[model samples]
Structure formats: C-alpha cells, structure tokens
Target: MFRLNVTTLCAIKWDCVIVDEAHRLKNEKSQLYKACYQIKTRRRYGLTGTIMQNKYIELFNVFDWAAPGCLGPREHFLEYYGEPLKQGQRISAPERFVRIAEERKQHLVKVLGRHLLRRTKQETIGHLMRGKADNVVFCKMSDLQIQAYRRLLRSPDFQLLISKDLPCTCGSHLTRVECCHRTAPDGVIWSYLHRENPDGCECCPLCIVLPCLIKLQQVSNHLELIKPSSKDDPEKQKKDEQFASAALGEDAVLVGGLQQDESFMGMSDAQHCGKMRALEKLLETWLSKADKVLLFSCSVKMLDILDRFLVRKAYSFCRLDGSTPMGVRQTLVDSFNNSPSKQVFLISTRAGGLGLNLVSANRVVIFDPNWNPAQDLQAQDRSFRYGQRRHVTVYRLLAAGSIEELVYSRQIYKQQLFNIGVNGTSEKRYFEGVQDSKLYKGELFGISNLFRDLLETVFTSEIIENHEERLTGIHRTSSEQCAKQGLLGEHAVSSKLEIEDDIENSELSALSQEQDGIEDEIESPNDTQSCSESQYEHILKDAGVLYAHRNEEVVNLGGAVQKHKRPKTKEQICSMNDPKTLIPSFVVDEHQRLATPSTLKILSENGQEDDTVGQKRKYEEIFKLEEMDETTKWFLSGSSLCPTQSIDCCKAVFK
Candidate 1:
C-alpha cells in the first residue's frame, strides 16, 4: 500500500504529517511533491539539514507545503523573494536593485524564522566528528587524451554548436563576405542533442552538442570509455558511431583521434589516463599503510575501467552502483567494512553517496567532479560523518585545463548561490563577466575556452587564485557569524541539544588525536614533508593545481607559499645552476605577458605555420621577443602562475 497507493493515503485527512529529507520536494512538479501536496492536513512539518540547495524557488516549495499561503502563491513568492534576492547577489546588479533585493531577503528570512528550526551539524554534533581535510587534485591529461581533445575542437560540428562570433573555417562553402563568421544568424535554434547549421546543409551530417560534451568528459576520465567496443549494445553503438563521425570528422580516428597503434592499445589502464596514474600512486601509498578507501565516480563506465584495473593489481575491492541489487548493497558494505581483505569500496556518486556510512575507510577519492557541488560534498560526508574512527581525507580529482575545470568553476558559482540563500553570506564576485544565463562569454562561460588552442596556460592567475580564495572563504564561516545572521534558531540553545553537541565534539577530537598517532607511524619524515604535493609531478608539471592550505602553509604543493616566486634562500643562491641566478627577477605585466604568443610562428588558412609571410611575421616576432621572455622563458610559457615558483628552476635545467 505504501508503494502502490501513496496517493490514496494522502486522500485521508490527518492532524499532521512529517516529511524527512524535505529538500527532495523542492521541485513542485515532482510526483512526490504532488502527492505530499494532496494530503489534507493543517499542520505540516518538514525536516532537512539542507533546506535549500541550488535555487530560491526551492525554499518556496518546502515552505508552501508546510503551511499553505505562507510564502503566498508561487508566482508572488518568485516576484518578491526570488528575483530580487538573486539580482542582489550579482556583482553587476544596479545599486537600487541590490537595495530592493536586500529588503526582500530580510523579509523572507523573517517569515522563515517563524516556521523553520534550522541547526548546523557543527553546532549540534561538532564534538563527535573528526577533522576532515578536503584536497583538490588537478590531474593533467595524457598525451593521447590531449590529441583527441584538440581533434574534437577542430571539427566542423563543434564550430556550429557554439553560437558565437568566430573566424569562419568552412572551406569554400561560402565566400569571405557570406561566411557566417559572425555570431550565429538570427532565428538560429539549437536543441540539446542537435544544432542547426547557419549556412544550412554544408555542415556535418550530425551536429550533437551534448554528445560532443560527453565525449570530452569521457576523454578527460579515460579514452577507453569512448572507444568503440563489441560489448556495446547494437543501437547504442550505431548512435555512438554517428556521433564519433560528427564530432571527430569522418576521416579522423575515433575516440580523440587516437592512433591505431598496437603499442597505444596495449598500454596499461594507468598509462592511458592521467587521473588513473595519480590514483595508482595514491592507492600504493594508502594500501601499504593499511588504510581503506572509498572511491567514487559519476560514470559507471569509468567504474568498469577501475574494476578491471583493480583486478589486474590483484586488489580486493567491492563495487556498488545503480545496477547493484538493493538486497546485496548492505552485504557488500558490511563485507568492505568488516573484512580486511577488501581494500577498497568503489561507489557511484549518485547511487552510494547518501545513506551509507563507510566509517571504516579514512580516505575518500572523488574520481571525477560533478556539476552540482552538493553531490560531491555529500560523497565526502560519507566518510566524515558520525563515523566509527579516523581523520577523513578527501581527494577531489579534476582534469587540469579541460572542460572539467569549467564544470568546477560553475560548482563554485552554485555554492556561492547556496551560501547567499542559506547562510546569508555573499562572496566577492569572481565570475563577473561570465554570465551563466544568456549570451555567455568570458573563460568560464563560452565556446572560446572549449576551442582554446594553447594548452600551456589552462587557467589565468585571476581564475585559479580567485577559485582558491573563494573555497577558503566558504569553509571559514564562523558559528558566531551564523548566529548574527539569524541562521541559528532558538531551538539550538536548548540544554539537551547543547549537551549532546559537547559530547559529539569531544569524541571527534579524541578520534582525530588517535588518527594522528596512526598517521605518524605510517608515514616517514620525508613522506610527511612532501605529503601535500602532487605525486604525479611529471605529468602535472604543466597543469594548474588548486592547492589546499593548512596552518598558513599551502597544503597541496610541498607546503610552499602559492606565488609567482618564493624568496630565495642563501643555500639556493650558491648553486649557479639555479635558474633564479640566470635572469634578473622582475614581474611581467599580466595583460602584456598573456597577449604575447609562446612562439613567433603564424598559422595560415590550412593550420600550418606559414614561412611565406616572414616579412610581416618576422617584425612582429622580433617585437614580441624583445618585450617578452627576457626575465625567464619559463615564466612566459608556463601553464599556470598560481601555485609554486619552480619555473625558474625548470629554466635552469634546460640552460
């Protein structure tokens, strides 16, 4: 009756109804929300730690269900509360609009205060939880992956997908005057799967925007996921073949245009993917220390790759995904927790992120990032929450300078949105020019970033520095600030809740101390010194890393201060081989530095450097060279300037 006749139960009148995980009903259009709305009750109660996740309308839905007309009609609430509050959060919104939005926000909060009793985990159970450190690992893409990525960008289908002004590349289909080179022509409409070419039928037979994106994401993780296999369902394979042709062009090799070399295909899974290589190193270190791990990925196909890799390594692991039977899930979880042989528990972020407590595993790996930051945060909490023991360390892996970075930047945006709505804290506007709504531009928003040719610089200092600053800001919110903002309710001050909170906090502290002792025994002095640095330094040498910080020291890059140059020590100055001694230290103008090209070559129509235009190119190259690379060629050509000042050292090695 509970499963099949939920609506029938709602028909009967009741004095009250209580809802758990009430945020699920945020979408008013959902069947659960509809069923819950149909229930006849005067008093409706909703309970959820996270009442609002992404948008403001969510608050309205939860509130309206609890008390009819409390937030007024949906349209009224949106007009007064939603739009104004969102507008004020924007960096560019007018002063008047910001003022109006603030007023609306205050009123909304006051109204919420009457009905809502919100309490934070820190306040209620801070004593019971151990210290959890979140480290963001930016992994570089394999050489094969980079080639495939560039191949997709060069495809005609990709050009048609992003409706923005770009130099026309369609050979001979239209003249220089009529080449649809400007922003897509008026009335051009694009569906999620397919896009209409502005110049009509001359474009590729299939222009799929979504598939192109999925392919890039797949390449970032593992090229084998997109590689055609006989195991694929016939219809799915047919669709994939069509997409491959459209995305990579008919003449190009499939799956990032990988070479059909036996050597390439015969490479080990870790050798084929950069993230896998990092994971391999981490597993080696962790498993040796007898530390269990919970690894999560958004893609089930990626999990299959991991499963195979684990089998090759002869590592005992248990897996759970959407396909895992409900009855067997608990058994698998118990086996992983109780059995010492089970070294790792692999989980699908969507399937295993919630409800399950894997307290036995102290380390967690978010193999890939999700667009929704909440999903990733939830995955981290599985190990960190009211756990049995140990300090939880979460490693969030991202493909540096790829589409994954864009996804993560948006995650930061969405998180700021959540903070504004719930915690009443607003962050400095980082994505100022990058509009997420319409006419998207800037590095974080549009097609220009996707078509970026230079892999040398993935993220500008402004982008990565701002990203790190914003993350730090989010985690540093104090309980006093929350109280001043009225997020902490009257109920939180109750003696019973306060007593429980104290007990939990003490337990958490005790667990952390115990874990510290264990970690000290496991890692040696040198290992502890470099514990914060990326293990795969060779591959990530040119990648942008978002370093974590602890005790005023950068925690993810050998505990160095994140800067363009670190103050040189006297011992470092004695070695003439040190690049710092080779060139005079000077700060280059960021704007002028970025504008200068890495090389003095000019690409002609056919994508080849043309020596034929040497006269004009020669003068330009000479001018650029005189202005740039004087202090250090390494600084001018480095991938990112946010963390570590090793560019001079790298230059010294070459000299």
Candidate 2:
C-alpha cells in the first residue's frame, strides 16, 4: 500500500533495476520484492543464473511486478494448482500451475529481454587469464566463537534443556509418558560431569545416551536446584518417598529417548582461517586482470577479511556495508565509477545493492551467496545496467558443500515457491513442518559442505599454479618498466639567477663615497675638536679641489666673520657684572676691531688697570673722555649692528 513520491519515481524512470540472485525474490512477502515493486521504471531487469529453483512460487513476487496481475492471487491459484497435505507433508503443484508459471516467465522474458542481461563468467569470459582462483579450507574456529559455542552447549543451565526439564528432579513421581523432562545426556556434558562430580546421584545416573542428551540432563538438573521451593520453611525437605519414586519412574521411562548429537565441536578457528586464506588468494588472482570489480558478500565480517587482504596487497578500493551512511553511499558509487586507479569496490549486498549504478565495471564477484536470489541479482545489476559497454561477467564464488551451499539450495527452492504463487501462510506452514528436522540436524559441526568446497580447489592444483604464474609475470613487469623511466631530467635545477653585463661598478663606488662624505659632514661637529691642524689642512685641500671643479659662489671669510659680530658699544663696561657684553659674539671680529695699535693700547691698559683699581676705573676713564664731545662720543658709540648684514664697525670706532 506504500506509495513512492513522484520525484523519486521520476528519478528511476530510465535507470535499470537488476535483481541479483533472482531466486531470492521467489517469496512475494519479502521486503526486497515489495520495495522493487514500488520502483517506477521502464527498463527493468533481473540477473540470476539459477532462475528456476526448488519451488515455482519463488518467482511470484518478481513476475508480479515485471508483469503485474499476470500471476493469479494466492488462494485462487493454490486452489487450482496445489494439493492439501498434513504436517510434515509437502503439497505438490498441479500441471496447470506449472504451465501458468512457465508462460508468465516466458512472457516476462519477451517483454523485458532487451533490458535484462545475465552471463556467467564461465560462459562469457572463459577462464580468467591474469589471476589465480585459490581455495583454502581452515578447520578451526576463532577463539571467541569456540568458547561461546562450548559455553552454550556445555553449561548445565542452557535455556533449551532447562525448559524441557530433562533431568527429572522430583525424585520420580510422574510417569515417563507425562514427564516433560525426557532427553538423553550428551557426551560433552557427561564427560565434564563425570570428571568433576564423581559421585553420581540416583537422578544423575550415567547413561549411554547422545552427547546432546547429557547436555540437556545437566541443564535440567541445574534448573531443578534453582527452582523455588513450595513450603514457607527455609529448611523444609521433601519426605514423600513415593514422590521420589514417581520422579524416578519418569526418569527411567525418559532415560532412553533420543536427541540431537554434539557434532559442532569440530568447527575450529584453524579451519576458518585456512578457508578464508584460500578465498583471499582466489580473489587476488581474479583482481589481477580486472580494471574494475565488485565483490559482494552477505557477512560484513567476511567483507572485512577481504578488505584486509586487499589492504595487504596494496590494492585501492572502497567498502560499503549496512552501517554506511546514506549520504556517503552515493559518493562511494561515484568514486568507483570515475576512479581508474581503484580496482575493487567491496560492498555488502544489503547496503550497496539497490539504486547504485556501477556499469563502468564489467566484472562482478559474489564472495558468498545468500538465501535470497533477488538480493544477489540486485547486487549484480549494479554493473550490468544501462550504459554498460562491455558484456558484464559475474563470478559466483560458492563454498561447494558447506552451510553456504545448503542455504543456496534453499534459495533455489524458495524461487520455485515464488513461481507457484504460494501464499505466505502456506510458506510458513511448510517452514514450520521442516524447521526442526531440515534445519537442525545432529552434527559435530555442520561444515562438511565447507570442507568439500575447499577440497575442490585443493584437488585442482593447476588453477592455483596458473594463477601464481600469472601473478608473478604481472608483478615482475608492471613495476620495473615504470621505474626505468625516471621522473625528471638530469640537468633540472630548482632556481636560476641571471646576471646583466651593463651595470658599472665605478658608479656604485662613487655613490658609496658620496654617502661617506654626507656621514662625515653629519659628524663634523665632534671631529672639529678632535682633528689636528694638519688634518684640517688636508680637509681644506680636498674642499679646494671640489670647489675648483664647480662654478661655486666664493664666500669672503673676513666679510662673513664680520657679519656675525655685534659691534661693542663704547658706553658699555666689559666686566663680570656685564658678562654678556664681555663675551665677544665673534672672535674674528673682536680681534679685527682690536687689531689697531691705539685700540690694543686701550685694551692692554684696561687689563693692566684691572690689577690696580679694577676694570671699572678703565671703563670710567673711557666714558669720562667720551662725555666731553657729544657728537664725537655719539659717533664713537657702537649701537648700529646687524649680525647677518654687512656692519660699518670700523668707521664707527675710528671716528
């Protein structure tokens, strides 16, 4: 009744849908078949070699969708085609139903033949040339699996045995016919009990029953002790000897009953490891020639083993399992489609089988087959869809005689059931009748099929030898040719610097000298006192050469020095009290104004006068003489002075 959205249906319009191991969809009640039915598409296809399995009804779900309403409803079809039977009975299909199924199948083939394609590797690809197919059979279980199975089987309180109450704990009151506890002791439990608890009680008698019976008895006894006592008194004991007798009678009657034997103990880790290694070797051989491949497995754990092998061989690949995120699943698909270097795409059939296009790959490998043919076919169609250029080849690597083969056989039978239009009720009835007998047989380990599968590869040593030879050749030539051609040229350098011949060193030298001169000029104040007179002379000589080359303005040293001096006023006294006036503004000007004999005499007299009556007396005498002639004194007073301009201090002093 569920409907798909228009957008989703539109997206799938032209896309091809491949139902892998098509036998699985034989049952119309399967979720896979229901989902496929909801897909709206024109190019529908199914890929399965074992299309006709045990029962015809197996193909009902597929044909129902491929050609809707072609197969009649469950009741009408069964009424006409099937015969009723009792429990543990199989209903035989009539000739009419078989003909209808065949006709429907033929009609489906006619309608969708162009879209559908299937080819076994043996039929199409012939013998693979590059890689070896190897099979290794390991006869050991992982430590954990072994321990867990042993714990379950050997424990005195295993649920199945305890529920049956096989030990007869009431001291024998009930008759054997009515007693619920009726099973023989298994060997493993008996061995443990006999070794540990030597004192065998009446109820725990040693018997020559099957090992499973011993297991059941041990579990029942454990359950009896743990059962709640009826009386309120904590220490109350049963005093009825007759009750004990009855329980004993029940035990006696049930003592010889048959049960399943203990045979699963034979499955060991060594066995699994050996078989897995053989499978890995086989896959390696197949991968050697394939440019792209898809490996399908039911168990994620098996996929993990293949992943490890691929990693060891340095093959680049991607893995998708039930846990893969939906968003990332498409990315992995796209990567597989586009990447040439990635050779293997490891996918769990359940996770990556539906809605993925992998037509770029021409090779498909099924590592292990599942009960559902539809699931296997869906997984294979990932590569065999539209846009697939080459003829797609599928390799089904089945363990010839293990539980895998048995499951495969069941799948085939289920497909047949689908073709017959068997209803869910009928299927369930069939399953219930055969569930205990067909599924749970007594075996030390139900791995005989697995052993036979590995033995097939062992017996055929030529395949392994051929694979090894091919692998050796591929490895030998592949890397050597790539290595001989180096990555770069011998003369290649990382960086190169080019030099120009036109640049002159003399110009640079001249610029450096000019910089040095500017630096010296900045330091001239400090060097002025440090330099000797001879050094000054050499500097003047260098300045003269530089001065002569340029049309420089000639500065008069006498006139420039005269411009810097402030003329001394005749009215001012040059004493410590007038220290500002005593210090000459320019030494050259002071010396020049005092250069005349009369002026020198006056200055000398002023100095000599300081020793007698102090320098004040000399200044007083000069001022007293100046007071007699106003005009002469005013003329003699040096007041008109401009330090930056030409000064007439000589005329003022002489007048």
Candidate 3:
C-alpha cells in the first residue's frame, strides 16, 4: 500500500507500492519525490496516463520514482533528451524538428514503458461507460441586472483601473462579475476614491475589489445579498454584549428578506436570478423523477443564498460548508446520503470536495466555474466515487457572453496541459496557445465592444439616470438595499413592516380604552378598594396568554366582551378589497344594436370651442373615409394638393 504523504510512506517499509497520477512526482526538486525516493520497496509500480507536461525530464523523474536511476542521472537525461526536445520545438524546419523530437520522445517512452503499464480508455475496456457527463448552461441577465452591471463598469474604480492599463486584474474582475453580478460594496469604492468614509467604508482599493467580486457572485444568485453601509459603534457595545449573553441559538445569522411565515416562499426569489429561475424549473422536472441533486458553488456566501432559496422552496436539504463545524460536517453528509427526506445537498466546493463519499446524489450542479478546473472536477467526483450506482450528470451554470466562457475555454487548456504531462498526449491543432507574458495585462479581462456599447447605453438611458437604487442588488443585504432604495423613493419594505407593527400596537391601546369604558359602566365591585383590585384582574386578562398569570382572579365582563379580530382569509381579503377607484360606467346600447357613425353625436357642434376644435378633426376623419375611394386615397396621400386653397372647392367638384 502507498500513502500520499511522503514522510509517512518513507518511514514504512513496503513489499510493493503503487502511485497513481505518478506525474505529481515528475519534478525531482519536489519534496514528495525526494521523500518518496527514500521509501523501501521490493517492487514499485508508477501508474499514470499523463506525463511530460513541459519537458521530457518529467518522464525521467517519474521513472526515477518507480525504479531509481533507471533513466540515468537527472542532469544527464536533461542534457541528452530534454534540452534537444525543448529546442526542437523552436526549430525552423518542420520535418527536421519532428524527427529530432520523435527520437527523444521514443527514448523517453521506452524508459517509462519498462515501469509503466499504460492503457487508453478504448484499449483498457472496449465501450466501457464513464460515470460523469458534463453539461454547460448559459443564463441570461435581466434588463435591470444588465443596467446595474453597466453602471458598475463605469464606476470610478473601474475607469481608473483601466487607465492604469491593467488587463489581468480587469480580466479577473470580469470573471468574478460573470458569476455574481457584484464586485465591491459602494462604501468601499467611494472610500477608495475619496480617501473618506462617506459610506462608512474604511477599506483600501485592493480590499474593495475582492469583496466587490464576492458580492457580485452573490448578486448573480440573488440581488438581496448586496450588503448595506455600516460602521462599528462603541455606544452599542454594552447592549450587544448583553444580547450575546442571552444565547437563544448557536448562531446569530440574520438572512434578510426571509420571513419566518414562509409568505415569500414562491417565485419572487427567482426574479433576481435567471439561473435561479432556470434551477427552479430544472428542480421541478428532476425532483419529480426522484433524482436527488447535489448543488455546489465555490462561495459559501453563494451557498447561503441557495440555502435560503431551498428553504423558501421547501426542499428538504443538508448543507456542508467551511463553517459547518468538523463534527457536524460528516453527519450532514451521511444524513443527506441516507435520509429519504433530504432531496438536495447544498455544498460549497471547498468544503465538500476532498474526502466525502456522496454517492447518494446522482445529479450535480456546479453553480459557478472555478479558475482551477480541478476544484470542480474533485467536487464532481464526490458523488461519482465508491457507493454511487447511478450515472452521475454534472451541470455547469454560466452567464452567456461572459468571462465564464473564457474561463471554460481556459479549463480546456489546463486539462490538455495535464494530459500532455501525464499521458504524453499530443494535439493536432492547439486552439488556445499559452502566453507567458499576458498574466499581468488587463486585456485578459478587456472590456469588449459589446461591453463598451452597454456602457454607452448606461450613460444615454434614463434607466441609469433615474433609479440609481437598482445597483443595490450589488450589495449584500436587503436592509442595505431597502435603506438606499427607501431614501431614493423605491419601496422601503422593512419600513412598511415597522409601520404595520405600530398600527397593531395602536389597536391594542384602543382595546385598553374599551376596558376602561366597561369599568365606568358597572360599580358593583366599586367599593373603592374592591373596584381597584377588579380593575387589575381586568387588565391582566386583556394582556393575552403571553403575559397573563394563571393564578390571577378573573372577572367576566360578558356585556363588554371585545370580539377578537380574525386574520384575513383569501376570500375575505378579496371581498374587502374594492376593485374600483373610479365609478363604473354602463355601455349605452341604442335598441341593443351597434350604433352607426352617422348615429353618433357630432361633437364639433358643442359649445366649448376648444373641445369642439379637437372634435372637428375626429369628425373629418370619420366622414372623409366614404365615397370616391381612389380619389380619397390620392387626396389623403397629399398628391397634387392645392397647398394654398381650402379643400372645400375640390370637395364640391367631387360631390
């Protein structure tokens, strides 16, 4: 048996050792290969389908691990084969270069073949099935989302970054924004530009960019994630400490826009994300067939959005993210795998990728693409490994015409690089050439012509000019969104809810007034001291079950009983709601027959001159439609018209 940790493996003597993905030790300079070289083994088998990513020396290193010094010394091998093969790549004569490269390649392959047992998928098991099928889905950005995206691109921070001519950073930002429709908090951006905390942001430009990117990812999932402006206050420290002391729950997480009543549980959440809409439809179809789904995103912030969404949707789910304490993480994983009630496992790629066996879920949805494709691949393998019996299908969601497309393309390039190194694979036509110098350039995330047009649209349209609050979707919380939007005249949902609470309190106060009026109506217990005691019991009963003591003496105020108002039912709501704001008008059907144009009142004769003038044109339009159709059509076209003359003379001639 072989171990991945080099030190442990070296310490244990083994009769036989097998290393998978042996190319990991292709670098002789790596600690893994050096430590592994010291391991005592009677027979070592190095298994890999990919070897020699950059040079032939990689193949030499792998062989050295499997059977030490079989390919001669590292330096000698490089001088004999690696240098010539690397130089031959730049050689001018194609045939000559091919001959020189092939010779070196054959020698390296011969050395590797002695210790390596290699087989292609076709050669190993003819027509054998693969467990995973990759799918890419493109989501359309909503009109409002598009407007917010353009406005963000035009922000001072983005423009300055462009002016500094940093393409790679721009590219990085683009990749980030493609997933979630956000980049930085507005306060952070404002602070960086002004060197002032107008929005209470104290972060630097660099700090702002990362959070902005995180928020953007959150926005792509749900607009409400955009965090509002906030500042730490020392005055509230005592109150906060006291609140913390009264531990009601393990966490004090307040996810906004989520009502405890499950009222907003349906489709309203999907409006902010096209992907969410797509996912809802997908879930409805797949879940009906009893297919369990494993949904994953790299950001826990995104997983939180999904968690809230799944709960609102009433989907039985289990979650495993970084914050899920180690003890509970596996329990959640096992529960999801075995529990029939749980249909979804909402997972963050980072937390769930390494060692969890999630063979229970047959379907996986990768909500966002990763820069390093292996992270996603590992996440997919979580469900496909060991206990899985079903053919696992993977869906990767991305925005159309977005940086995700570029990232997807880059993933292919990375996979090819791995294939070349581990399997000695070659391509006929390399589509995306790796450029070493481009890592620093902003052109990597270069604003395209389409992006520029969107920017121009933002400047020219009223969408950006007038409702600036649309960008609140770029924030992290509904409170921030509501505060900004409320000030900007958009619906302040929380403020309305607060007003409603005040109105309810006022109604309770009115009930207390009714209680006082009843006391005045009766004086039986009114021996001053006795009446005062009765009044105390009367108030106690009115306080409701929550505050009323069970031992308190009760008085039956039968005549003055207040009827408890029942919550409005759907039908009751419909009945109480008056549909009309204006008086309803009855259609006048003269003798139940359609009225002819001639029967209609000629309004030009009305006494109101201005009204008559407007009506005159309508009358002209009506009568002008009749008789001499060709002549009428010609006259209306303004052909051969007497420009100076009133048309009465020509009309008379026609008559």
Per TM-score, what order, best first?
A: 1, 3, 2
Model 3 Cα lDDT, one tens digit per residue, 1-655 = 3436766767778999877767688787887777778888989887654554334566677777788888789889877766544434321225475456546655655555566665543233322323344555545555444444544456544543333333334446444333322233333343433444443333333444553344344444444444321232543333223222221122213223221112344324666465676577657655766778999988765676677788887889988888889999888888988888889998889778767888888778888877666677778878866556555556677644444444554454455443333343331112312222243222123333112322222121121112112212222243344456533122223323333344345335434743442211111121221123354334322321011100000100011001112322434322322111000111111100111111121111111112211222222332233333445433422323331121344456566
- For all candidates in order, the CA lDDT equals 0.57, 0.39, 0.47
Off by over 4 Å in 3: 1-131, 166-221, 225-268, 325-330, 426-433, 438-655
Instruction: Count residue pairs with overlapping backbones in model 1.
Output: 5
Task: Evaluate residue 417 in candidate 1 and report its C-alpha lDDT on the 0 to 100 scale.
Answer: 59
lDDT per residue as tens, model 2, 250-343:
3322222111111232111112232343334434544565547788877664565567656766788999999989899889889988988888
Report the poorest 10 consecutive residues by lDDT, candidate 3: 549-558
lDDT by residue (476-549, candidate 1, tens digit) is 34333544665434432232233234434533543453333211111122223224323433323333232221
After best superposition, candidate 2 residue 375: deviation in angstroms?
1.0
